[model samples]
Target: MTMDSPIPLAIVGVGKIARDQHLPSISRTPAFALRAAVSRNAEVDGVQNFTDIEACLAARPDVKAVALCLPPEPRFAAAITALEAGCHVLLEKPPGATLGETDVLADLAREKGVTIFATWHSRFAPAVQPAKAFLADRAIRKVTITWREDVRRWHPGQGWVWEPAGFGVFDPGINALSILTEILPDEALLRAARLEVPENAATPIGVTMTMGIAGGGYEIDADFDWRQEGPQTWEIAAETDGGLMSLTGGGKTMAVDGKVVSDEPEAEYDGIYKRFADLIEAGESDMDMRPLRLVADACLLGRRVAVEPFHE
Candidate 1:
């Protein structure tokens, strides 16, 4: 097939992530072309750009796929629109604000014979595959995660993150859950949780949760905070057979028995694009909502706590 005949892909919500990760990865991958980008106030160098998705779709009907990098609140509508337009969709993390909405999109994609990839980019981290292999047969007794970072450093002046529908701390927290679920042998459930919302913000700035898994009862205690002053830490340590397994630096490094096993530079989004290409070639869809489901459940069941107001 010719290059022009390749899968035409579009990107919605051309925000920081879309420019930083998605665009670079898509450019390097052969399976897709940056046919169009839809955003209210951004434009690509050469590819077609639109202020709205409908305009893009109408102008470029051959676009077979859309990658949604919008905030979780408005993701469902764009995803549904893409699916209805006979295009496969790849959604950013926290697929939708509620699990029910994502479920509907999944079903609609199936009915439309189009793929819906609810991507958890963290799961594609370099160390995650090895971490999953190391703990496959071991008995996981307990797991602890510390995911703390300065929101301003990572998110910059993105005001939407503190809004009611933005999911705030859970945004990064859900990434940890995604990796946990992928490495765990059995499915887990949220046992208890505490959320600390800023007095003036609609979303929580900090969260702590305990999760329990079936079959021998593995436990996971997770902490997410946006007030870290010094170095950011994204660590997951588990007490398992043979010794302790720890994945640190957000899956960029791994250790067993305090001995370094895997430490590599990050290429998570590159792997994601490769996988998307593979899925398209195989005419398959890869959508897993387990991680997002856990987040929604936590929101619904978690205890609310009041914290001091956060200011930018």
Candidate 2:
């Protein structure tokens, strides 16, 4: 669609993220117009709302694209419905529950000639690209990621996060992985991982992993926990031949050798929507699965330690 005439877009799952980020970004972006919403328990004002994706697609035939913001477990089916209906699709972080499901969706998108974007919103942080550019030519010696937050503060009553495939701590941990994957010049390969799962929960509440570059020069150590209180930490640092490069504030700020280079307020979702527009305009899909793959690897290779039961 032309810039002057924005593409009619619908959002499936008008939950926390939809209300907090997607709606605001959509309102500001000229590339898309909010046309409809599909949510079983929520609705977007000033837009057509449907309780089911099928009903939304059947009714809002004019909608050219849809953003799936639901939990990973149920996202694949909603994305399939959107792609099958000839609508470009945007998938929220972690893509789908399984890597196989994402591949299937990609194949279907290709068959339907529709753009499908598996987005890692953290990668869109303002300082991320600059960090990537800085690290492109430097020899990375070691990378450290410390991502800790209180799930109760971020997720609140979201019980689905502790279920099977809910990802638990990995849900936020994958954000760090996305930034890591984006900034590293070479592919990062997981070496070992330890997961601390609550005795009563299916997913881990904390994760510690070691990874190395595919070319075998550098190493990465990542620690993710959902037990931090008061001030949260989302920081990544890379020690390189030149100096130490730090990305903090969830990638909104960056520093090199203790000197700040780029520090900006968070507007990652805005960038995400803009990139989605660009991908649709170019008739292409961006379904990077590296971050998700790393999580999958952890699940496959990680040593699970049963910790105390987690209570909200």
Predicted model with the maximum TM-score: 2
Model 2 lDDT tens row, 139-216? 889999999999999999999999998999999999999999999989999999999999989999999999997768
Best by lDDT: 2
TM-score of 1: 0.96
TM-score of each: 0.96, 0.98
Total residue pair clashes for candidate 2: 0
For candidate 1, the lDDT comes to 0.88
Listing every candidate in turn, what is its Cα RMSD in Å to the true structure after a full C-alpha superposition? 1.7, 1.0
